[model samples]
Target chain A: MVEVGAHATAEPLVGASDWDGGALPYRVGHKKLGMWLFIMSDSLTFGALLIAYSYARISSVAWPRPFPFFPSIVFSSVMTLCLLSSSLTMVMAVSAAKKRDKKRARKWIFATMFFGAAFVILHMIEWGHLIGDGLMAFELPEEWLKIWPGASPLFGATFFGITGLHMFHVFSGLCYLGIIALFIKRFDDEDVEISGLYWHFVDLVWMFVFPLIYLLSIKPS
Target chain B: MEHQSKETKFFNMTLLLLAGGAVLVAAWDVAVSRFRGGTDDLFFVLVALLVALLFATPPILFGIRTGWFHEKFVIDDEPPATEAAAEAHAEAHGVEGESHGVSNRLFILVWIALLGLTGLEVLLGYVQLRNDLMLTILMGASIIKAALIMAYFMHLRFERMSLVLTVVPAIVVCLCLMLILFPDSFRLFHLR
Candidate 1:
């Protein structure tokens, strides 16, 4: 039985040790894998924030649904479209890089950055509308309580906290793509793919943020 | 060259079959709602179908990139059997395999699907379901979209299965652990 156990363990030990000596045990590039690890940790960070926001929301007597359909919801939906388009453009850029079409890849990368910037600008405009309505980080607008009595002050806090973090990620993704696009000639295809991973992840997070934050809170007509 | 063992092949095929079924169901749902002629029914159907598609498309695309569906189209011109040899071959060649590399068309479809899903989410918002139900549906749709982006656009599907196993489970386990705190919120709600 001891010999049997030793034989069973020996196979996996050999397999496990393959990654120890500079070999790509996962058959993935070190940089790409490293980025993936970063993304995983970042996902947890966002996940925790989202969970905390949800907790505050459910526990509160009332959460403000300040976004009306006309400007807020429509604007955010357009923003979602913009981010999705950027992800498509990012894919184009990655595929172009893989094909060694540097010029075309650079063009696509710029296109992605353009869309990402558009999303940020649109988001800023949305924030402008909210702040103009007196929605501060810690204070819900006085009018909001008229619509939703007992509205939680935490609404503004969580909304800004979550969406602000997402917007920062979008802004950072734009800058990251800009740097990659500028240095397209120097960076290899994997770098482009890695950047694309980050870009897509930004879009991925919006998938949750848009619905939970915007759609869920659409003011009843 | 690495060969897919019979069990792995079977598992992949099973995943493909389920994805195909999901697509068919989504199409059917849309058609049924169209025939019903209620605008609200249409919105409900579209939202429901989007939910199904969110779960469906990734597996099919994963299969395509892994060359499970179109294996016959793969040009397996062999030179040697080492991993380095494969890497060098891929370097010399543009892509590892033409059929195995996910097509640009597939990504566009995914993009459109995402947009359609978002549109449906908005439409569902207007439908005025119960608050709990609406939140549940929205959360479900968002998760599906995230999964689609991660699987296709991020190329997690093309990566080694072990990487997917590692990254996905870690996130899932962490999320599950966090779920234990949910009851605390309810207690707070009652206290208020």
Candidate 2:
């Protein structure tokens, strides 16, 4: 391995954080840097999944509409509302941490946890309803199978794959937030901030997911 | 222990998580198929649920003992030197020492806007406009909402340019990936 002491001083690359004993750019905390990078890559993951899902929709002749008209949109809208509300609570948690008000931060984190968990539960219920409608990730319902006998299996695969992956994120985010809640007294604003970043990203991804998955697919009555 | 932003290190969970997720999806597919296919075996569903429970445990354990992300990234928990670094960071962002620097009322307002946008989108979904136009409108509304959350809720506005630059490539790469979908659209139109 080349020793860094060889040059003792060379121009530091861009985006190098001072925390890593380097220089220039990335002056933020490790959590912030890590969280930011994670969000960036995570966003790309969702982007790729969404693009693939749309591609499948386009490539297929006729896709199944198992989500059931506008009611599914309404349910998902409420789910979106829960997540948006959780974001506010998450900000409140960070803001409270900034004030050194651990109690308020704890309260807000608890509230955020409640809201995030609520979204997941609502989401699971929505998924169950869709499943009850005879949708499976790898196979179409017997009804759909009869009509579009040659429809691409990708429709179901991408639907479940993309949405399932997002649901996993939501679940992991909730667990992360819950863990943060358990130790709110020892945490700081930056901790709350990073947690908020992850939570908001989940919300942000859902913002697009809601429109693309539910709204765009609404088959008019 | 200041870390460089240019460093190519990561706490990579992508492959592991993807593998786990794909397994869960397979389990889900199996469970659904068995249920629908008349097997009545709930083993796959149980496995899927077990995976979720297993994933939930790590973060809780991470909380108990500060994990790699916290051990490396959190600055304030360090010595006075890092505390000074934190202060310098706050000053650089013009957010030094004002607890809850952003307006709570404004945040609530943004939340309201998000809620209202959700309502509007849901309503618009009911309108049977031309397909492309409807998708465009819905997409536009969602993008606006995402921006609101990112700028205000996630505090990206207060972050530095370096952090902002990180996201630029993600978006650009996302747009580039859309090319993969282009060739198939013709088949979509003609094949049906």
Candidate 3:
């Protein structure tokens, strides 16, 4: 039996030698492992918000899905496409790093950064439209209150909370990628891959969000 | 004891075989649905073929190369092995093989697949399908997309099995939590 303390001493753990890192069993660097672990917990946070939002959706008979069929869906689809393209570029960046082509890697990194910022801008515009329709994070708009007095206020709260958190992720991911770009020469291929992992994760979460929030709620024009 | 290691190996291999079968069925199911529109006859055929292949693969490989299924070599401290021997042992088992390190080609393929799937998903949203069927398509497609991003872009494909275990368990737990609360979601709620 290999206890935690045995790992530090001469005592042998049967499987420990198979993996890398003297004290740790990590095959990847500790930093990369830490990023993955962070992503796992962050996903749960989004999951909880989505679950609560679903609860709100199922509980009410008439949730106000105020998105215009053509305009809203088109904007969102474009945003989704932008984010997805960014993921491709992120992959390109990592691939370039693997080949030790720093110039091409920097190009891909900048391209990814552009798309990330583009998604944030698009999202903020969508938020503007929603707010124009009286979608406040905390308070129900007076116009909406007049139409449905008994409506649950939880709808807007969850919508903004979930999507807002995801937008925050995009923002932070851009910053993280930018920092990686600044010190691209300092880090190994794994660091670039780790940052790419975070970028794809943000993109992945939107894969679920885009369908559930937009496609499912599309009302026939 | 050597006996215990063998038992452990068998147990782990069995678990792996089962997992491999599950991935096959899932991918096959998705393919059948997306390609064939999920006809029941095709499903049965796919299932039968997949099961046969799953069962036959391990035994065939084992017969061809005994000790191929053995766990990666590790140096226990009872009698220390030389570094050269340890490297040779690790090399022979093929356990340290990195999947993505093969080339950038795999990641490119995965990227194109993701874009194609996203396009398919968007196109299906406009099609007049049953709500349940549409939901199934969306969910299945989303799962594949997520898996690809994790395995390739995230480089989980190249990471050791322990890191895979670390991230996957959390996702499974979250999914189970969602399932537990799923029943409540179906119930009608009244606004106060």
Q: Rank the candidates by TM-score, best first.
A: 1, 3, 2
Give the per-residue lDDT digits (tens) of candidate 2, residues B16-129.
Answer: 474478467757677568676322234345445445544434333333233445665674554335443344344444434446345577677788888898899888877768
State in Å the error of residue B178, model 2: 4.1
Flag regions of model 2 displaced more than 4 Å. Answer: A1-24, A69-71, A145-151, B1-95, B178-183, B188-192
Across A63-159, the per-residue lDDT of candidate 1 in tens digits comes to 8877888799999999999999999999998998888888999999999998999999999999999999999998888888898899989988898
Q: Give the per-prediction TM-score of chain B.
A: 0.50, 0.47, 0.51
Provide TM-scores for the models. Answer: 0.74, 0.69, 0.71
Q: Interface RMSD in Å per candidate, to 1 decimal?
A: 8.9, 9.8, 6.6
| Candidate with best TM-score | 1
Report the TM-score of candidate 2, chain B only: 0.47
Deviation in angstroms for B73 in model 2? 44
Over A1-221, each residue of candidate 2 has an lDDT whose tens digit, in order, gives 11122111234544333334555344467878888888888888898788778877877767765455545766787888888888999898888888888888889989988988888888788888778867777778787767666676676788778778988998999889888888876777778878888999998999988888877766545
Two-chain complex of model 2, DockQ on C-alpha atoms against the true structure: 0.23
Q: Quick one: best DockQ, which candidate?
A: 1
Model 1 TM-score, 2 decimals: 0.74
